[model samples]
Target: MTLKRIPYDKPVLFFGNIRDLFLQKVTLHEFMKSYYMRYNNSNHSICGLYVGRLPVYQVMDFNLTKDICNRDFDHFMDRVPLGMQSTDILADLLLLSPGPIWKPTRAMVSPAFSSGKLKAMDVVIQSCGEKMSQHLLKRENPDKEIEMKQLFGIFTLDVLTNCIFGIDSNPWKELNSELIAAFYDCENYSILTHLKMNAAYWFFPENLRRFLKVSVLADDSVYFAANIIRNAREYRLTNNQRRNDFLQLLIDNAAKEEVKKPENRLMDEKHILSQSILFILAGFKTTATLLKFVSYELAVNPEIQNTLRAEIKSVLEKHNNVLNYDTIQEMPYLEMVLLETLRKHPPIPRFDRCCIKDYKVRGIDLVIEKGTMVYFSIIGFHHDPRYFPNPEKFNPLRFQENRNPHGFFVFGSGPRNCIGQKFALIVAKYAMVYILKDFGFFSTNKTQVPVLGKNGNLDILIHPKM
Candidate 1:
């Protein structure tokens, strides 16, 4: 049962030979399509890979990705080397850790994301959505296109404040609040930070948590969060009242940690504080990127936008403009629109898993030696015409009709898939529902055409310019 190998072209594999690794601009979708066509047509089919200090492989096969991400996961379980372990705490979160540490942390964190908790947090998320609508209305001028990146960032910041910190940052305020200022600093990915990331994989792997020196907020941000978490925990304890927010759930669960691990440092003060910081930082930026991309897609495709708005109106009339768990769940068109956006622009483009032991992929008896990096190309698969027909077009019908059920893998798959997928979906949906009900998304001349991602150390995380 030997599987076919897709041959790699030497010329393209030598992709980054120039003086600039950060500025190498290649149209990724176009590049992948050509690679897929060549492999599909070739007699000796093989996957293409770019060999360098890092063996970056670009695979377009959905079957192979499932094998790497699920069936053959033992061989491919660790995220790619971001640099060193000592510097990147965001990466250090459950998404980036290995084996024993990851498994237990996952077990503990899983309960926090249950449907009950998501339901409880709905009001907090809905509050943010209400603010986002007002915020957008204030910015609207006929025919004026606002740079949505910053605006979406503010919207997501408000969402994260309520979700994670249980407070309102009002990031949409004319004068930036302290929370907004810290959030802005946290979002800026500088060259020095990039170098520290590379250092994480090369030097101090365990010590290079994302809370280190990625930005000034990485350190100072933690301090502010500690005080917040402390006050919240104390308030919850002092008053026998409970709220439906992320902070409360985490704190409540933190108290029961000793029951699970009597020998370990159960959810102590530092642990709770660190987890809070991780949630605020990781959740906001990634969700904001998704929301902005969705908005951009709507702006560019007015027809699809009109169709969706119609559905939103029809559904809201059915449920009286209140998007409850049942109502938001019923909007299939909205789901399809989001699916299309995710397929076209996945926030985290690539995922990696390090080989923990020798293993096989599909029927191929290859050496999955320890330390072998098995990378999953999320964008490559999402854009591949094999899974998605007419990949570039803003067609929501692909998801609306369940034409390609296994096509989308934006939030990832398997056990390690994003725990916050439900959280992200609800936030984006409510935000869209509120904004579209009031204002229509329009394109501006200042908007950058064919949005380009800045290529460098942080290439795995894609950010769009407004």
Candidate 2:
């Protein structure tokens, strides 16, 4: 209740905002954007609110957001803890692990996405994109209104499975493959499940929540995923096979860690399994969602689409019509279109960082205490007219002329940013180029002129309604 005393641009309402969010009165992004606008002109750039009893400070100023994420990253190095019990596989995720566990795991995983590693994985990505495009072309009614989310979901899942696990899921051929089934099960939650989770999140203490074993993922799906990884590892070792993929990279790292001292070992079986699952979950839906939006945007804006297609054509011609790492990098207009799409529809609406040390704002009297959750709304920043004029308009030219890195939180900012960003972009761009080169996207009767988005339960990314 003491958090209510903190200076706020609007009347301090302890439970009003959270109550609206829990009751589904307002989507999470809408709440954040409204708060951001309410506080944008205030002397202080931060506003206080309560998520249940937990006090959270929402950062509104772009400069302050930059400082917290980049300049003073050490003071806010870790995300707000999910508070899952130690035994849960989610506990060891690099996204949720504390500084000590996260640091070394990040170091090990970072190399897997390096320029060389990505170049090596380019073939796999291109193959998946080609399969998707071929499938689309083969469809009985090519111009029929196709649900792009499902289509891109298949492509992204195929790409992730191949590039991460070195397994050809062949999602194009078998839509209900075991891998796809498990992933869908993990994400599929019923209305009752959502109600239970909302109740627990708002009312249950961390210890009690963990005691109840309330997990965002289904237990059976987790077991199935774990078994898949274990099987893959055994098969690789038994066959003496080597692959240039994320799982193989982790397997090699784990092998190297065996000789290191216990304190020095960066990865083990649990680390590998958890990180592999995290990468799959993290990359799958977000990239699919990005591609879906990009496709939709191009469908509606044919001029921009044609311009982007011309660029893609020119770049691929220079690279001998091969959609490779270098080819993707040469398409600057593609980059701008992607950036504009991300600006309009950031997969993750809100992200947070926990204050590890009490820190005073440089220009304000407020001091955010250690352990307080600091929230950043990607919707607020991306849609702010001050930073992005006519934010609602789908114009890639904004990125071409005046782009502010600080205002962009699509991949997030600073050290704790999404590590798989490059890989995600590569996959998305390859798919776009491959499909656009052969087919043109045009809006249909079912196409939502201005796409609407809905927040999913426990989803870091927002899902669009086509």
Candidate 3:
């Protein structure tokens, strides 16, 4: 089907010049909502745009979105609009890789994220939570504007480092903790990284990205991680001790695969090292952003905060104040609050799927052609009043009723949904329990209301105002 261009009189997307692009850039999610309100009155609607040099389609209806994500899964497997160039720094990680490569890599990493494994890592999770509570307790002054976002970042780092890499980084104790410093250093210099790290392999001859010396890991980051992984591997080999951390799991699986399939080689040291770094990226930033958002919502909605606090107190008292997987799982209200927050402020606002084969949308019979990028507006669907009544109200009861499966897709849907969703929820829940049990969280003037993201930090991931 052809794109229908609405007249200039319409209040949707009326771009006359490059300057209009600036006006549209205020808040992307809001801009899309306005467009949807203007043109999308039915179950299915389309909007076309130029995202850099590529053509893109924005799909609003949840049915078409689910069709691309589930029913037409194969055709929509690996097409994120930004594109994953084979030579990019994250090409080896499951998040960026596509097709055959993503399949095996995802398989190798999947078991480590299983619920059983997360349960096994309970000690690390509890330890990190206790550490965060102790740290926050010491600084309980009311007037002081504590940066909860930064605090949550530290908590997430501590959890991921210990659980994944079998290391401990106390970012709360030292803001510039080695791992935290390394992460932000890489983040600050991200644009400079690709050129510096993979220029010879990825960049085109005349491209400006060639001049940007951006390494996947900054010098300090590389030294820190490379040393940790190299030493950990050496330690495992020397001591013959097997830990249940993600690093150990990867090594065991890789070794097992090597024995099972003599023809194809298993993951080697570089692969393990790359995946470990990927775990840090996947685990820390997104989880931290989620926790921060939950905190923001909790701060504004005191009644919900009190309700969550009561639930945590009751659950912990039942389990003798021990945060185990089973006890935490039993906390329904807590889960609903977290679920509601996810619905309101999803970590990843949008998902892009490529149409690998022609498929007709149900009811409409409109054929989505191969190579067309299908953009799913996850935030749009979550906030749509069709499923969530009084959408703007911060209410957790919607999730309690099992209102609609397609409506609450914060972690995405189908097979290709984020594998680390369970792990992220575990981290957020554990941290929330700790904070609520000990102290109260309130937003200060520094905490920006109607939170907007900083310019350079706008990937698929979400970051709240600090």
Question: In model 2, which residue pairs have backbone atoms overlapping below 3 Å?
Answer: none
Quality of model 2 by C-alpha lDDT: 0.79
Q: Once all C-alphas are superposed, what RMSD does model 3 give against the true structure?
A: 5.7
> On a 0 to 100 scale, what is the lDDT of residue 186 in model 1?
70
Please give, for residues 345-448, the per-residue lDDT of candidate 2 as tens digits: 88888899999999888887778888888999898888888788888899998877654555888878889999999888888888888878887777755676
lDDT by residue (tens digit), candidate 1, 1-466 = 1112435555333232211332224444444434555564343212545433334444445676677677876666666544333333333455656676677666766766788877777777788778776655554453445566667778887878776667766766754677666665674556666544434433343344533444324655655655767787788779876766766766666667767765784456555665677777777777877778887778778788888889888998998777876788878899889878888877776655666666555544344446555545667667667677888787888875673467477777666777788778887888788878777776655555556652211111112211
Highest-TM-score candidate: 2
**What TM-score would every model get versus the actual structure?**
0.82, 0.92, 0.83
TM-score of 2: 0.92
Model 3: weakest 10-residue lDDT segment is: 457-466
The per-residue C-alpha lDDT of model 2 at residue 419 equals 98
Rank all candidate structures by their lDDT, best first, as comma-separated numbers. Answer: 2, 3, 1
Specify the highest-lDDT model's number: 2
Q: For candidate 2, which ten residues in a row score worst on lDDT?
A: 457-466
Prediction-by-prediction clash tally: 29, 0, 7
